[model samples]
Structures are given as C-alpha cells and as structure tokens.
Target: MNARFTRFALVAGTVAVTTLGPSVQAQALPACASNAICLWRFQDGTGELYTWRGGYVDLPSRFTDHVGSFRANRTGAFVDWASGKECHSVRKGDYASNYSGRFGSKIDAVGDNC
Candidate 1:
C-alpha cells in the first residue's frame, strides 16, 4: 500500500509539471483572459478582438502562426495578406492592456488601462 501511494503521488506531480510548465504549441499561440469589460484578444502574439455588440474584454484566442487567416469581428482584423480574408486569434502573452470603453466592430491594440 505504501508503494502504491508513493507511485500515485509521483504520477500526479509529473502531470502537473508537464501540463503548466511549458507552452503547448511552439506556435499554438497563448492563453487569453476577459478583462473587466469582457472582450476577446486576438493578434499575432497577443492582441484583443472587438465585437459588434459586446465591448472589449480579455477574450481568449490565438494568432495563426502562418501569418494569415485571422478574422474576428472587425477591429484588429485585417486581410489575410495571403488569403485576402481576415482571421486572426491569439491568447494573452508577454503583456496586454485593459478592455473597456466603446466596443463595436472596431478596436485599438492599446487603450487606456482600466
């Protein structure tokens, strides 16, 4: 019984280390969060996405490592450059600003912090 308990603890510890230690996708973008305002962020490395109805937030999305296929709402969105369509999504990274104020089809990468 003692051996079993020890082994169980070891496995649990290993799982925790692997799960949160490293970034899953070398190019899988990062994680995102909803700010007080509640908006989604999506950019190359870390940016926000503006919705039509909902204002700004720390939404969770990722940037397509490919450099194209990024389209969400309108703001911060641009032609795929390669695909000609807009489609970008990325999670929080390094750092990000706050989400508040007017929230509609258009968004600014950096805005006044809340």
Candidate 2:
C-alpha cells in the first residue's frame, strides 16, 4: 500500500509540472500597469521599458527614436514622429511585438489621437 501511494504521488507531481510548464515559459511580455502604455527598446517586449498613463508625453532622449515594441492598455493613443507631422494610432489592448521597421526609429511622442 505504501509503494502504491508513492507511485500515485509521483504521478500527480509530474502531472502538475506538465500542466504548469508552458505558462511559466510563455511570459515574454513585460508587465504594464492597467490604463497605461508600455514601450520596449527591443522586439518581443524585451529591453528597456517606458510606461505612460495619459497626456502628451515626449519620449525621453534614450527612447525617442529607439522604441521597438509597444503595448497599449488604455482607451487609445497616437504615436507621433517628425515633430508630430506623422502619427500612428493604437487602441486599447493593442500591442506590437516588433514595429521598428514600420515606425522606423522615428517615434517622437505619445498622446491621445493624431
């Protein structure tokens, strides 16, 4: 009976590990607080992080033209470039794992609307 219990415990432990493995390994995106936008310096949400809640915010010197990915957790926002001449909109729950090519190291500011 003791041997049988040991076998059952081992099987249960293996099952729990198997069930939880994938989720633990899938956390690639950095944490962004609710009602904010998070920008990463590299693709797949890796590297330096910048977070904004609202209003017109100019990117800091380091992040200005170096934003490589973004996750917008708010209602909406606009990304500006060339001193606001060019803009891109991102809605709530929108995210880009890699946008370096599309925006091309030209993101200047972030705010509501274009």
What CA RMSD would candidate 2 show? 6.5
Tell me how far the alpha carbon of residue 36 in candidate 2 is from the true structure, in angstroms, after superposition. Answer: 0.2
Judged by lDDT, which candidate is best?
A: 2
Q: Cα miss at 2, model 2 (Å)?
A: 50
Name the lDDT of candidate 1: 0.35
Candidate 1, 1-114: lDDT as tens digits: 999999999999999998889784434433333331223443333344332223333322342221221222222322233344333333222222321221223232222222
Q: Candidate 2 has which clashing residue pairs, if any?
A: none
Give the best candidate by TM-score: 2
Deviation from native of the Cα of residue 32 in model 1, angstroms: 20
What is the TM-score (0 to 1) of candidate 2? 0.68
lDDT by residue for model 2 (1-114), tens: 999999999999999989877662433577689989999888889888999888898888888878888888885555665664888778888887786776727888888777
